[model samples]
Target: MTSKNLLTALLPLVSDLSRELPERERYRRLLEAMRALLPCDAAALLRLDGEWLVPLAVDGLSDDTLGRRFKVSEHPRFEVLLRSPEPTRFASDSALPDPYDGLIEGFHHHLEVHDCLGCPLFIDERPWGLLTLDALDPLRFDSIELDALQAFASLAAATVNVADRIERLALRAEDEHQRAEVYRQASGQQSKELIGQSKPHKRLVEEINLVGGSDLTVLITGQTGVGKELVAQAIHAASPRAHKPMISLNCAALPDALVESELFGHVRGAFTGALSDRRGKFELADGGTLFLDEVGELSLTVQAKLLRVLQSGQLQRLGSDQEHQVDVRLIAATNRDLAEEVRSGRYRADFYHRLSVYPLQVPPLRERGKDVLLLSGYFLEQNRSHMGLGSLRLSADAQAALLAYDWPGNVRELEHLIGRSALKALGQHRERPRILTLSAADLDLPSPSTAQENPASQLQTASSVAVAVGDLRQATDRYQRQIIEACLTRHQQNWAGAARELGLDRANLSRLARRLGLK
Candidate 1:
C-alpha cells in the first residue's frame, strides 16, 4: 500500500481499536504509519514522561539513546522549539545556542539522523510529546516533504488528543456527564431573534444566516447595543464548533503589559506577579469560538501577534518562546468602522484585511424598522413576570414613542427600557404579577426637546478626551454599559422606579442590563 495508503488504512484499524488500544500497541502502530509515510531510516515517538521524554518507539537508534530518557532541559534544539511556533530545521540548527554543542556530534553521523525534523504534539498549546524523523543524509527533505510531515504530526496530535480525552472522561464520568448536560442545554436554547423587520435587519440576518456555518474570521460592525456580540454568538453556535465552549474576551479591556498574557497565556514568573502558569483565551477556546469583542481596540504590538496566530494556528505563552498549536473559530466584533480606524492609523492595514475576511454588519436598533415594537413586546412579556406584573400591552401611543425614540443603545438598550417600564408599573415591593400600568414617560425616551436639551452635555464626555488611542471604541462601550447598568440597580429591580429615577424607561432598562454581566 502507498504511504498515503497507510493513513486511509488506519481508519478501519483505529475503529476496531476503539474499545482500547493498549498504549504500547498505539505507539507501535503510529510509528509504523510514520515510517511508511516518510521512508525514514530512523524515527522516534518520544512520550512525555514527567520532566523527561522517554523514547517510546524508534525505528533506528543506538540502544543507549533509543530507550534512554532525555531531560528536556538538556536538549537545546527541543527546548528552543518549545518556545517557537516554527519548526526547527537542521538548517536552522546552527542558529540555536551551543548548550549541546558536542553532546550529539558523533551520534548525528552514526545514525545518519543528520537530517531531522521535529514536530511538537500539542494539546491546547501545551507540549504533550513530539514525533521526530531522521535520515542518514544531510538536507534531504525539502519544503513539500516537510509540509507532509507537519500535516501528519497534526493528525497524530488530534488522534492522541481524542484518545486521551476519552480515557480521562471514563475515569471522570461525573464531570463528563455534567459537561454533556451543558452541551445539551446549550443545544436547545434557540438563538435570540435579530429583532427587526426593517430592510437593514432583514439584510443583516441574511448575512448572518448565510455565513454562520463556516469557520471564518468575521468582523461585526455596528453601534453599541446593536447586538454585535449576539451576532458573533449566532455565528459560533451555528458553526461546527458549536459543541465547544464559545469563549469571549474584550481586547480593549487589557493593556500592553497584560494583553499578550491574556490571549496566549503566561508561564510561571513570566512577569511580575506571575506566581503560577495560566492559559490564555485562545487555548481556552480550543476547537471553539474565540470572540475578541472590540478587536479594533488592540494595540499595534498585540495586533501583530494576533495576526501571526491567524496566519498559523500556533501560539507561545508570554515569557516563553515555545510555540503550541491551537484550534479555534475566531469571531471578532466592534462597533467602530475598522476601515476608518485603519485609514486613520488606529489599526494595522494587514490586520484589518485579515479580520475583514468576512465583514458582517449589524444594524442599529433605529435601522431595524418594526423590530423595535416586535422586540419591545417580547421584552415586556419576559420581564413582566419579574415585575410581579401580568402581561403588559403596548398602547398605540407607547408604540409610537418606541419608534420615534433614537435607540442610541440598540437592542440592549431597548430591552432595559421595556424591562424597567414593567418593573415600575408593578406594585413597589412584590414579586407577583401586577396590572401593567404604564405611560409615555415610562419608556424614558426623550422627546425632541429632551434630545435638543442634552445634545451638548452627552457629547462632552464622549469626545475630545484623554482616552487610549487605539482602544477608544472599546472605552466607549465600557462607559456606556456602566451608565446603563447603574440605572438598573438604583431602583432595586423596580424598572419603573429606576426609569423614573434616571428619567428613562422601565422596559429598556431590563434589556440593556446584560452589559454588566447581569445575565
Candidate 2:
C-alpha cells in the first residue's frame, strides 16, 4: 500500500479504539504501519513491563536476539533514562560517553546502529518504558523525522497506558461494583469503604479488609488529603464491630493537658471547665474503632496514657481515677516521619512499633498515574449530578491542564476544584453546557518557573511554539489559546472564580478552550 493509502486506512481504526485490540496484534499492526511510514532497518519496539523491557515487535533482527529477554538492568542505555529525563542519542562514533556501553553483545553487535533515538515513555513524569529505534547505516534521523517518530512513540505510549488502565479498571470496576451492590443490598450497611478504583487504592482496601476482621492495630501513613481518615472508616465498617459507632479524635487539635481528659473520659470537676461527667472517645467506641488522626502530635503525657490503653485495653478516667476496661480497635494516622521521631525521642519507640502492626501507606495523587483523569471525571460527574446538571464532559484543553497541574492537595484538591467549577457554572446559567472547561487561568495556579525567570523570553517563546496550519479556524484557535493562557496567569488558574469574576458560563468558556488545540 502507498504511504497515503496506509494513513487513510488507519484513519478509522485510530479514530475509535473502543474495541480493544490485543497487545500482540496492536504491536504487530503498529510495526507494520510504521514500516510503511518510515522504514528503518532493524526497528525494535520495547514494551515496558515493570523493570524489564519485553520486546513487543521487531523487524530486520536475528532470531537469537528475538528469543532473549532485554532485562533493563542488563542494558546500560536504559539505566540512565530510568534514573533521569534526558534522551539518549547513539552513533558508531561519538565524543561523549554513550549509555549503550555494554548493551550490544554477541551476534547482535553486527547490526551497526549508526543512528538511534531513545525517549522515555512516561505515564505521569515517571518512566513507564523506553522507546529505542536503530538504523544499520550512519546518521539517519533528522530533527523532523525524530519529531515524527517521537510523536508516533507518544501515540504508542498513550495506547499502552490506556490498555493497562482499562485492564486494571475492569478488575477494579468488577470488585467495586460487587462491593457497591452488596452495600446497596445491605442498605449502606456493607459499605464499599474503600472508594478508589486505583491499583494502590484497591490494594490498600484489600489489605485493610483482611486485617479489619482481626484485632490488629493499623497505622495509616500518607500526605495530607490522601484520605487516611476514610481508610480508617473503611476498616471499621468492614470489621465485626461494624454495628457499633466509630469515634474519632485529632491528636493535633487538642491542648496538651486537655488531650488526656478528652481521651480517657472525665468525671465532674475534673478541671475548671468539667461541669459534667463526659465519656471519652474510647468509652464511646468501646466496641468499635477510635481513629486517632495526626497521632504523632500526642504529648508525652498523652503518649504514656495511649501506650497503656493499647497494651492493656484499659483506661483510667480523670478526677475519679476509676479504672475502666474497653473493647475497641485503635487506628492511628500521621503524615510525620514517626521512625525519625522515634530516633529523636519525641515519640515512644514501643508506641510506634505497636501502631504499625499493619502499615498501610496511601500513594499520592501523582503516583496513581492515569487515575488522575479517571478520578477527575468521577468528581466532575458527581458535582454535575449534585447541581442537577445534565451529562457534561471536560474540554480537551481543560483535561490536559488538569493532568499537567501538580496536585499538591492530591484527590481532595481535585475534588474541590471540580465541585467549585460546577458551582461556578450553575450560578452563571440555569442550563448546563455539554462541556466544562478550565484553562490554565482557571486552574488558579501560580506563575510557572519558566515565566518567573524571564517574562520576555516566555512571551517570545509562546508565540513560536505552535506551528501554523492551513485553516483560519485553526489559527483563530491558536490565538485564543494564548489569550486564555495569559488570562490564567493574570488571574492565577481560578477557573470558575475567574470566569464569574469575568462574567461567563463554565461551558461556553470551555468550548472556546476546545478550539484552543484544534490545529
Candidate 3:
C-alpha cells in the first residue's frame, strides 16, 4: 500500500462523511476500501459496547459473523488490539486463538487464520472500537506499512463520529450522555434487543419511538411466541424513566388467590401463606415502568381491582387499610384479543380501554420474511458460544427451509428449533468438527407441500374424533387432552417446549393439564 493508494481509499470515506449514506452502508464502504488497500482475505469493523465488541460491518466473513458479540476478555487478540494505540500485527504462529478461525467466507473446510493485524480506532481521544484484518496465508501482512494502516484507522474514526452525530441529531429529544447511560444500564441487566430489518419490524419501531416518550399505557398484542414481552421492554427502554427499574410480571403464572397479592402486595398475616409483609410489583416499579405479561389471563375480579389502581394511582395492599400512591407507566402484553373479551364480558371494558391507549402489535416470525435468517444468525451465535463450537452456520438449503416454514409457534419456536437442531447435528458427528453446518435435514421441518397440507389433515382427524365422542363438551376435552399428550410425548415431557408448540403459556398449559387430569 503506497501513499497514493492510501489517499485514494481515504478520500472516498472522507467524501462519504458528507454524503448522508445509511450507517451500515458507510461502514461497508469503509471495510471494502480497507480490504482493497491492504489486500487481506477478511476484514471487519466492530463497535465497542462495554466489554463486548459488536460487529458493524464485514467484507469477507460469513453472514452469521455479523450477529456474533465478541467479549473483549474472551478474545485475547481483540483485547491486545484494543489496548494498543498504534497498529499491531500478530505472528503467523501466535499462541492466542483466532476468533475468525473457520469463519472465513467461501471456505467449507476448517481453515485457521494465519496472519492477523488490527488497529484501535479512537474519537476525541477515547477508544471507540477496533478495525481488524485476517488472512489465511502466513506473512500476508508482513510487507504492509504500519503508517498506512494508522492513517486508515484515523479516517475510520471520523466516519463513525459522523454517523454518531447523525444518530444523536435524530434523537434530539434525549441528551446523548443520558442515552448512553441508559444503554449502559440496560446492557448490565442483559436485556435482549429487537433485531429485524423487515418493513413490519421497521413500522413497529416507528410506533414505539412515537409513543415511548409519553406516559400512556401500552397494550401489546400478538400471537403466542411473537415476542410481545420484548416489545414491552423496548417501549420502557425508550421512555423518560429508562434510568429507573423496569419490573416484569406474568399475570397468568400464578393462581387467582395469589394474583391480587402479587400485584398490590400484602400485610403480615394477610392470608394463610402471608407470614411477613411484602411489596408488590406496583410498589417495586413505582418510579419506573411496570410490565404485565399475559394480562388477559387476569380474572374479572382481579381486573376490576387493577383498573381501580390504574385510574387513581393509589393501591391498598391485601388486608390493609393504608393506601399508597405510585407513579408508574404501565405496559401490558397478551396474545388473546382483549376487544373480543370485552364484548363477551370476560374482561372489564374500562380496563380494556385504558390499556389500549397505545397499542403495539408484534409481527409473527413467518410474516417477517428474511428476518428469520437474521434471527437464526443471532440464535446460532448464542448456541455456538454456549456449546464451545469453533463456528456454526446454516447451509443454503437450511436457510430456504426456514423461510418456507409457517412458523406457527413464531420466534420462540425458532429459537428452540435452532438449539435443538444444533445439538442434534453435533451428536451426528463421531468427533466435534471445527465448523458445524446445519442442513435442511438437520432442521427436520416439514416440506413446503407437506406443511400446507398439515392443517387440513389435522382438522379432518379432529372432526372424526368429535363425531365419535357425540357431545360438544366431551369432544372438546378429549381432543384437547389427546393433542396435549401427543405434544408432551413428542417433546419428551419438556413442558416448556410442549407449551410453545401448542401456542400456550407454560403455566396456562399446566393448569389445563391438571384440569384435564393429565398432570
Candidate 4:
C-alpha cells in the first residue's frame, strides 16, 4: 500500500469518531482496515481488564475465543506486549507458547503461527489494550512497517476513547431521567417490610439490617416463593441508595438472546427489531440497587459478562463499543443452589464467588412457626381492603390449621390461602358480614399425618411398593420415587437439602421430579 493510500485510509477511522458507529463495529472496521493496510491472516482487538485481556473484537478467531479470558500472568506474550508502549513482534519459532494456539479460525490443528505482531494501544500515555496480527507463513510480516502500525494503533486508541465518552454521556442522561422518576414516587412503595416476630424471622431481619448498609453484592437463597424479592426490597430500602430507584430484572423471565441487551443497553439497529437505542437495567440502577431474581437461570455466557461488570464497574452496550461506568449494589436471588450449579458446570464459578460476597438465607415459612399466622393476617388484611370488606379474621380452627400444616409453598402459599379462604367465607354469608370469618374448611388445610409424614416411614412405604411391582422398570421407578420422597420429607420439602442428600442440584432434581410428576 502507498503512503497516500495509508493516509487516506486513516481519514475514515477519524471520521468514524463523529459518526454513530457501534463500538464493536468501529473496532472491527478499524481492524479490517489495518489488516488491509498490513496483510495478515488473523487480527484481534483485546481490551485490558484488570489482570486479564478480554477480546472486544476479532476478525479471524474461533467463536469460543471471544468467550475465553487471557490472563496476563499466564500468557507471557500478553505480559510482554503490556510492558511496552511501542509495537512488539516475536520471532516465528520463539520458545514461549502462543495464547491463540487453537483459537485462530481455520487453524485448528494446534500448529504454531510462524509470525506475530502486537501493538499496545495507549490513551493519554496509559496502557489500554493491544491490537494483534498473526500469519501462518514464516516471512509474511518479516519486514512489517512498524511506523504505520504505531500510527494505526493511535487511531484505535482514539476510537476506544471516543466510544467510551459517548456511552458514558448517554448513560448518564438516562440515569438522571430514571433518578427523577424514582424520586417522584418515593412514598409509593411495595410491601417490603418483613412481618413476623418468630426467632427465625427476627434473625432474618437482623441479617438484612446488618448487610443493607453496605455496597456488597448479596446472594439470597431459599426455596420457591419464599419471599426472596421482599428481602431484597427491604435491603434496598434500608441501604444508602434507598432514595434512588431499585431496578430489577428476572433472569429466568428473559430469553437467552435478550438477556445481554436487557442487562447492558444496546445501540440502534444492533439486532432485529432494535429500532432505537435502549438503556438496560444496570444503567437505570446506576446509583441504586439491582435485584436480579432467579439469577441462577442466567446462561454461562451472560454470567461471564455479569462478572466482568461487577468486577470492573464497566460494561459496553450490545453492538456499541463505548464503555459505560455504573455504580450499583446487586442483590441476586435464586431458589436453586448456586454452589451445586457451579459444580454441575451450569454456572460460572468466578461469577458465583463475586455474587456471594455476603450471603443471606431467607428462612422458609415452615421453619418460621407462628410467623405463618402473622403473615396470614397481613395478607388477609390486604385482601380485605382490596375486596372492599370492612374487616376479616381467621377463625380459631383456621388459625390452628395454618399453624399445624407445613407450608410447602412458604409464605406465598399462606398468603394465597388466606385471600382464598376470605373470599370463600364471604360467599357463604347470608348477609354482608362486618367481620368475615375464615374456618378450617375455608382454609382447606391438609391433615397433619399426610402433610407431615415421617421420612423413614415414607421410605419404608416406597420399599414396600417397589417389592410389590411386577415389572423391573416399575420397581426401579417406584424405588427412585420413594428415595426422593423420603429425602424431601427429611428436609421438610426443602429442595436444596434434598438435592444435597441425593447428589443432585436443585435444578436437576426439579427437572427429575417434574418428569416423575412429583409436583
lDDT for each residue of candidate 4 in 210-306, tens digit (9 for 90 to 100): 7877789999999898999989988886677877878989999889999999999899999999999999999999999999999999999999999
Highest-scoring model, lDDT: 3
Clashing pairs in 2: 441-488, 441-493, 442-493, 442-495, 443-493, 444-492, 444-493, 444-494
Question: Comparing 1 and 3 by lDDT, which wins?
Answer: 3
Model 2 Cα shift for residue 480 (angstroms) = 34
TM-score-sorted candidate list, best first = 3, 4, 2, 1
> Worst lDDT window (10 residues) for model 4?
172-181
Each model's lDDT comes to 0.65, 0.64, 0.85, 0.78
Q: How much is the lDDT of residue 482 in candidate 3?
A: 82
Q: Report the C-alpha lDDT of model 2 over 1-519, residue by residue, as the tens digit.
A: 244654664554475356577655666666666555555555566656445565555555432233224446545666665665545665557433332221232222333236666667777765677666556555666532554555566666776676666755754443444434443444443232333444556678778768876778999998898888988877776676666677899989988888888799899997898999999999988987789999999977788778899899888888886789998898999999999999999988988998999888887775554456667655654554455433334544455566555577987898898777666655666565433444445555443434222457755654455344556555556655665675565445745433442346767777766656522
lDDT of 3 by residue, 1-519 (tens): 668888988888888989888888889999998988899999999988778788889888877677677767878899999999999999887878788887677876666648899999998999999999999888888889999999999999999999888877886533634753685576575546687876678889888877888899999998999989888877777788777788899999999999998899999999998999999999999999999999999998998999999999999999999999999999999999999999999998998999999888887776666778878888887888788887788876687788777788999999999999999999999998777889899999865432223567877867887888788678878878888887776455868656765667899999999999998
Ranking by lDDT: 3, 4, 1, 2
| Alpha-carbon shift of residue 428 in model 4 (angstroms) | 2.2
Give me candidate 2's TM-score against the actual structure. 0.50
Work out the TM-score per prediction: 0.50, 0.50, 0.82, 0.53
Per residue, candidate 1 scores C-alpha lDDT tens digits across 176-277 of 334444544676653343444445666776677568666878888877888888888766655666679888898878887888988999999998999998
* lDDT score, candidate 4, position 175: 47
Candidate 4 residues lying further than 4 Å off, grouped into runs, are: 1-187, 447-519
Off by over 4 Å in 3: 173-188, 447-519
